[model samples]
Target: MWLFVVLGAVLVLVGAVWALQGFGMLGGSAMTGSTLWAVIGPIVALVGLALIVIGIARRSRSS
Candidate 1:
């Protein structure tokens, strides 16, 4: 339960930063190569959100 929440938070933050950097919103020169985080960050964030929701629902049902 708590784990999901933590992971979700981390993912959301990482995803946001990656998305920002990837989109050049940070206003910096592009790197020589593509960064995987730009893809991974959002995916991880979604997974984390799903995990958190599932955990919450499961806990609620059990209780």
Candidate 2:
């Protein structure tokens, strides 16, 4: 449960960074302004959010 939360948080942060870079909002690499990253970043972030929600819900139910 805690592990999932931490993992999810990390994923979310990473996804956000990717998205920023993809959109050219945070330039400084080959991935910056890349269309592929722009598309994939949001999807990854959503998955992370889902994991966080699921982990928290499961933890609460078990408690």
Candidate 3:
């Protein structure tokens, strides 16, 4: 439970970073020639969101 929450948070952070770069808000990967990153950014973000939702749902069910 706690582990899930922590993992979800970390995924969210990583996703946000990837998304930022993909949207051209940040540097690094955005400037690189990887269209894969551009696509992956949003996907990662969604995955992160799903993870968070699952963690919350699991906790709520337990309590």
Task: Give each model a TM-score.
Answer: 0.65, 0.95, 0.74
Candidate 2 structure quality by residue, lDDT tens digits, 1-63? 988888888889888988999999999899999999998888888888988998999899999
RMSD of 3: 2.2
Clashing pairs in 3: none
By TM-score rank, best first, the candidates go 2, 3, 1
Q: Estimate the Cα RMSD of every predicted model relative to the unseen true structure.
A: 3.0, 0.6, 2.2
Compose the digit string of candidate 1's lDDT tens values, residues 1-63: 667667767777766766666655654546212366566656766876787787788778878
Off by over 4 Å in 3: 29-33
Off by over 4 Å in 2: none
lDDT of each: 0.67, 0.89, 0.73
- 1-63: candidate 3 lDDT, tens digit per residue: 767777878877877777677667777653444566667867877787788888889999999
Instruction: Give the range where candidate 1 is weakest over 10 consecutive residues by summed lDDT.
Output: 25-34
Name the lDDT value of residue 30 in candidate 2.
Answer: 96
The TM-score that candidate 3 achieves is: 0.74
